[model samples]
Target: MKRLRSKYTKGEEVKFISHLDLLRVIQRALRRADIKVAFSQGFNPHPRISFGPALMVGATTEGDYMDVDVEEDISPHEFKERMNEVLPSGIKIVEVFEVDVRDSLSSRIKGADYLVEVFLKKEVEGLEEAVKRFMAKDTIEIEKETKKGKKLVDLKSYLEEFYLIDMNGERAKFYVKMKLGEGSPNPFHLLKAFNEYIGDAFDLEYYKIHRKNMFLE
Candidate 1:
């Protein structure tokens, strides 16, 4: 048996589906496609299936991925066509690649790239200044609370790369590459950091954030 990594897109409405539900749907489709999966020896005996990092609800994605094991070698083309035919609408098989059995999809992820579109509430306040300032900070610290408790970390340090492009008028789209921040920071958290740095004039609700790319380090 070999492991296969598949990338998929959660189009429009399907973005509302949670990760667990998506797994159920994929498992059902795998059964319909007659693919063999390794199973656990435990009482539950679930198939050996692993997924990449979860995509948040309400966010459309083109880079969400999962890893599954098969009892026999299957070409990426055949597997992709078969699975795509059976997968529900809004969920699709984009690419299927053979991966080392020992490698983990989760651990391979080093960072994710995002394209955030921010629309000004009014005729623009100081967004350009805010973005420039936020992007230029030597260190931008924010409070992040986890089960281990809250800790302050530098936002700039976690940021690997970023770019700001003004769309039209007061609208701007930011292509930001963060080091996965390691501690599970979200787009809202990032916006919060910018607001904190530039002083509370930034409004998150006025903007729409899209995750353009996800990467493995």
Candidate 2:
């Protein structure tokens, strides 16, 4: 068996699908492409396919990763060609290569960068000042609901970088980098905290978020 790591894109068409649904789509595509993925050894065997991180619904991604163990020793180029032919329009395999079977893709991810564009109901002044104020604080807390209950999470620690990329009268775009995995906050949480800090100037729902890149260690 050979372990293959693939980098794919999640475009606007497939942004609304859940992570589980995306997995199903990929699995079906693999079967249709005639790729022999290795199955787990058990009564109810399942494909040995794994993904890096779960992307938020309604958000697009430029770079996402998946690792699959295939029974056949197919070349990376042939595998990519086969998979792309079967995958839907929105999801496309851009790169594929053989990987060491010892380490998984999710284990190597450390951080992710996001591009967020906010559409305001009305023009809000001092946007830059509000952003500065948010970053200047010692702690930026927001309520996060877990299985236990709602708890306040300090976003400042997970937030690595934040800055405005573009702004207009009723629209603003931002670049954000935050730590990923294990209790880390997503980009939406960071935006929620910022909106609260700025006295809820922008509507939380009126925004476009796209994951720009994932940083792996």
Candidate 3:
């Protein structure tokens, strides 16, 4: 068996697919490409493929990683070519390489960087100042509903970096870096918290969020 790691992109066309649907799409593409992916041992065997942290539905990604185990030795170049030939539009394999079978993508990913563009009804004054004050606070708490019950979580604790990159009339852009994995705050929720913090300064019309990259340990 050979383990391969790949970096790929999720474009606008597939941004709305759920993580489970995305997995099915990849598995189907592998089958159409005639790649012999290894299956887990059991009565109900499943493909031995795994992905890094799941991307939120409606968010596009520039660089996402996945690891797959194949039954045959296939060169990374050939694998990439085959997969691309069958993958639907908006999903493209960017790079591939061999990796130690034991290494897992999920465990190595530390955080993710995102580019967010918000469309507002109108520009509000002191927007930058509000962001500064929000970030300067010792704690920013938001209510999160978990399986057990609702709990207050410190949004500031999960954020490594965040700042406004640009702001024009009715439009604003931000760059955010936040922890990934269990208990990590969602970017959308973070934005909601920010909006509230500034006394609802953002009369948000809509927003576009794109994941720029993942940081690995």
Give lDDT tens digits, candidate 2, residues 1-217: 9999998999999999999999999999999999999999989999999988789899999888889999997999999999999999999999898988888787899889999998776677888777887798999888887778898988998899998888888888999998888667788898877877777767777899999888878
What's the lDDT for all of these models?
0.76, 0.89, 0.89
Residue 144 C-alpha lDDT in model 2: 87
Could you list the CA RMSD of all candidates, in the order they appear?
2.4, 1.3, 1.4
lDDT of 1 by residue, 85-192 (tens): 999899898999998889888888777777777665445566666677668878877888878999887777778766667656666677777766347666667877
Model 3 per-residue lDDT tens digits across residues 66-108: 9999999799999999999999999999999998898888889
- Candidate 2 off by > 4 Å: none
Better of 1 and 3 by TM-score: 3
How many backbone collisions does model 2 have?
Answer: 0
Q: Over all chains combined, what TM-score does candidate 3 have?
A: 0.95
Question: Candidate 3, residue 48: CA error in Å?
Answer: 0.5
Reference-based lDDT, residue 105, model 2: 85
Clashing pairs in 2: none
